[model samples]
Target: MMYKHFRHGDLLKQWAEQAEARIAPRIREIEKRVEFHQWRLLEAYRQTGVSEQHLSSSTGYGYDDMGREALEEIVARVFGAEAALLRPHITSGTHAIAACLFGVLRPGEELLYITGPPYDTLTQVIGEEQDGTGSLADYGIGYQAVDLTPEGKVDWPAVQKAIRPQTRCIAIQRSRGYSERASFSVEAIGEMVEKVRRLCPDAIVFVDNCYGEFVEDQEPSHVGADLIAGSLIKNPGGGLAKSGGYIVGRKKWVDRAASRLIAPGILAEGGATYGYLRDFYQGFFLAPHVVGEALKGALFASAVLEAAGFETTPRYDEPRTDLIQLIRLQDPKRLIAFCQGIQAASPVDARFLPEPSPMPGYEDPVIMAAGTFVQGASIELSADGPLRPPYLAYLQGGLTAAHVKIGVLTALDRMLTHSPSESAKLER
Candidate 1:
């Protein structure tokens, strides 16, 4: 009966029903992960004695802020890390990752990415070529990347060959970002960490844990990563954190990253919470459940889109390590229309249509449909991608599965009505 309110056609409705039936087992699997993570986080909160007093805000110097310290302890306990830095001062995931990189590597040392080039925003941070900007390369730090094999697995042989005396950091990006490759599972990351340790025992194994948090039973820190960083606005924010980022790992590395975030002496000792502590603590507590909802939405999108003849990575039944559901629309118009539909379903700014435009830190024009409460929050339903070949649309995040279902089905309706060829293919 609720379906009657939407503009979906009879055929589209039938296809949706079939997709839901096919993905029911997978949905149950995601629920299991949610339950496990929820209990795990609850235990962390209890062990850390999270109380109302620990949710208060800090002022000015923020020195001896018990709430700030407690929250960091909770994050560290949940992630199985020696320490954690949770601060609003660190603006984004890229910033957190950059701090970790700058904190660990000296001027002569190098950072090697085993999972190929990182997300687009990081290209500048790594400074593939030394520009006048203060990128890692500008500071005399070296960077190298080993591409994944054709099968989308780590190039172990290439990784072995790429190691040098100055290689001080081995970085792994757990999510696929905008690429078509599969996201690395926690087990796979552990394997990479073990091999990297064998090749360079002292090398810091870092993971960019952006959209990959809470999707797995154990985090990369639980495996063998020496350091990991992510944006609070992504999975870990639980759609509640207004703004922030987190870095967790070995105490020494976390302390170094804190130093990079603030100053040497103020490492994890400064930065006022400014009334965001309640949101951060509550958001973290709700993250596991919220991430589970996003995962379900991703699965549903994969099933529906794949049935509609669009090529989708990590098919509905596949194991997921992140929230991204990539759809290759093969045409720019359809890509735009897809994002428009997602925006139309959004709770905020739905009246505005998204357009492709140049954004800083990216090489190509990008179209983003993020009508979220928090600016640029991917934990809420959003779709975005570059305006380039294959016209891929990367759909991520939904606070609720019903919202994703309506949004994606609406997108399918819009695309089918606009493209006769697409409708004809579905008809056949």
Candidate 2:
């Protein structure tokens, strides 16, 4: 019933077989990277002397909790940061980043972005596009940006010229958020940091490091990032963290972020770990292998999608720095159909149809097909994108490459088959 409906089902099978062989070497290389990161994580755990006692939770102010203290130390050491803030109180990656931004910046200061507009969700946080919700701009923090060059590289000259006396922070988004561009490498971020220091020696260099963790041997902090933030449910969570975020950087910045996360006087003292410490610790340990699995899945997805006559960013053979895999459907119906097929493959909510609708912190009506245990965890196999032009579907995360292969094949089958009635549903 499946292949009988798909005109190109045979082609999809042939392409997948070929891609598996072609990508074998790449998969081996990713496996090596995973092993290296695992060693690094083990060393951090050893350095911090994490013990079973460190897995217990503390309630009623959560002060003097040895596990909490050691967890923070391990995270900071692993990230090459002077200090770190790891708290379940910090709800989302966006919340963690906002805490750092508000903590270090004053009302009169300016925030400059060397990397065009940030992710869509952050636009609302920056108050660049008004959402009627209070944001950094509402508090008088000014925001400005310098778009990347046509080739997707940093516009260094513009960045240098844009630096002002009021410029208090320079925001660098490491991943290509909702855009078809190359994500910045850790080495590239270091170069950007050096240039910024040359122009404004005192301005803080902040990196939105979502989706970039464990994908490299070194982090933004290792390359001179003064402040960096990310969500635990992403790469670092290893698909296990139920909720939380992290901020790692200089002691002063982390301290300020702590103040913002809790109350000014409490400052990292009152937040409770609620017995999630063990999962968080275990997640960090497993993150390297899990992230490697996601990357291999993306590479394989790229190969199969391209062979199916659709365009893909960072073709399977291209270098990757993040988990996102963009596919260009170029039509709303096809986009919806692709998402529906992806949703169908989900282990949870497979029977539910995903519809395009407005979500908080985004401008467009976005369509998403995610059935992750962590609720929007991108580290699991998921796909989503805005229902706007280019009609791109940003597919990311797969706990295993075999699952990703199945999802891709399923989507291709649905795209090529499906009754006119089902097509009408997509058209709706």
Candidate 3:
């Protein structure tokens, strides 16, 4: 009956059913993790004593805004950090990360990326090409990177050699952004922190924590990271926060980052919530369960898509450190059709076709299918990728497993109809 409403073919329906049966055990594993994190978050809220008074908003200057302060404290406690900076002023994950980098490192200091080059958007922020648009390089800050080994693991020897006297900040990206490598787990990050501390004792260990929140039982902050940053729209927002970002870490580091967000002397004391406090608090409180739902959707998509004859990273049964599910479509047409199907199944903008277009921060033309209630919120069901070799499609987020099933089945149907060759491959 549901298939008839969505117009999915019988073959696709059968495939989905079989995939669901095969992944039932794995889904149960994710549910257990969800329960653990949900309890942890609930305890954080209780310990913080969140109440109706803390939900109120504040106006200009935002002096003594109890709600904002309490929400930040709750977030910091949940993430196992000494302090936190939660603000609508920090626009994106990239912005939050930039604030941390600029806040901690001085003009003469250097930033070393140990995991590899960060996400595409950060390339400009680091001024790798030096366009002089007020990047770190423009401000006299230097940058260096240690590439991951051929097998996609951290190159420890290279990392040791890369550290220098000027290296003030050591950055690790937990998510595999537009890359074929696996996302780093929190345990792996702990090992990295230990090694970094031994190699460069004074260097700041900063993690780009976007898309990786609530995926594990513990956060990077708990694993000896000096600082961590992420966007609210990605995972911690729980699909409700309109816009915001968070930075959590050592008290001094968080204070420095806060100074960058709101000028010094008034650091962390000025930004008004303007009625967004309730969303921020409630969104965070619900984040763990919401992340669990997204993880289930990701698993369902992986199992169904892989069964339909496509390559997927971190197969359905593999351990997950982030919500992203990378599907290798191998053809531009297949990629477009996949995105179109996802868009067509979207609760919003279902009739509009998504095309590959040049986005501001990315180098290649990127195609995205996001019909979320909040603009560009990845915590809702969406798929996107760059138009390049292998033509990998990156799928992430769903408020519910049912929605993800519909979207993925619709995508498979589109792909099967678009290419007879692919359909034959599926049949065989």
Candidate 4:
């Protein structure tokens, strides 16, 4: 019973009922809509196709530059942002975030991670707590985190207390894809941002929107957030993007981020003009349907896993527009194996894989990859080991129903085989 929480079962049920109540209409329509659009996206993938513009491909930058420019134009118009940037060269979400963070925050000002202590790769980019030696620490800017509520809502009171005169900007994750429990709601974040605006009118509100884009009926910016950052390799990729991330919102932040794109006199539009163009186009084309499917996988995963006698965060069938699903294993070993099992079930080669290691070189080495059909986005069926007091395996996204079913089935099957004791304990 994914719904069973032992002592918290009733509480979980109450929460689920409330969530269902909130999104009843939308959830009701998603299933059929998602199925229809999925077939269309798969057909599109078979056509125009995708490639990393910045990678070591035989097709150089000049190869299809004109076609690429048209795509960027389409992307700029899709989201109501002043400008957009894209890159197939970058491999991960953190790299894109770093490009935006260091580009926007100055050396003298403090940057508050209002919603998070941040994803693991952040330590390398901004420095770590032990010595505070990352970008912010080494560069003289301060770093602070405002923990979320027990339900995973932003602690507004804490945010009020944490902001200082020197606080340059406040950062939070738009989707709690990485969260063990409560994901911050879009409406809640907007309300909180309005509060922050009242406190420090000058401070910027930045959102790291990894798994939340396209899935939400409303975006962080719709709530007046200064900037929203995330990559295309997830939901925004439309199950079609080969690779990329983006930062969109106000002009000041957009231009500043553009200024940070390296090479001194070099232009920012070089890589982005194409990669972003392609990913953005593909994203919208497949977004509604694909994300809906991913949500279904998350829903099914939560329900089935809970039924199998495990404690799941966000309790399956709980109100979630995003695709993330978390199952607590408690034991680190089981957590690692759980992640490994998810990876093994990926469409790509499973043999050349590494165990669910902490993201090497960073404090949190939890391994995860996007499970897509065409080396597609990982929003569906990607799993990672979380570093915490009690380890957990955080899973999210499924581009197709089949992908979701296969990946999740593989994960549960492995749990039954290698981690039977853990499964038995959950059921007990």
| Candidate 4 root-mean-square deviation in Å | 7.1
The lDDT, on a scale of 0 to 1, for candidate 2 is 0.87
Please, what are the lDDT tens digits per residue for candidate 2 over residues 293-354? 99999988988877667799878888777888899888888788888888988999999999
Model 2 misplaced regions, further than 4 Å: 1-9, 128-133, 419-428
User: What digit string (tens of lDDT, one per residue) describes model 4 on residues 45-115?
Assistant: 43434345422222343344644544433344444555555556656677678767877788778888877
| Per-residue lDDT value at 361 in model 1 | 87
Clashing pairs in 1: none
Rank candidates by lDDT, best first. Answer: 1, 3, 2, 4
TM-score of each: 0.98, 0.94, 0.98, 0.78
Which whole-number lDDT from 0 to 100 does residue 410 have in model 2?
81
Quantify all predictions' global Cα lDDT against the true fold.
0.91, 0.87, 0.91, 0.65
Candidate 3, residue 142: Cα displacement in angstroms equals 0.8
lDDT of each residue in 57-148, candidate 1, tens digit only: 98998999999999899999999999999999888999999999999988989999999999999988888556778899998999999999
Model 1 TM-score is: 0.98
Poorest 10 consecutive residues by lDDT, candidate 4: 54-63
The residue-level lDDT of candidate 2 at 421 comes to 54
Clashes of each: 0, 0, 0, 20
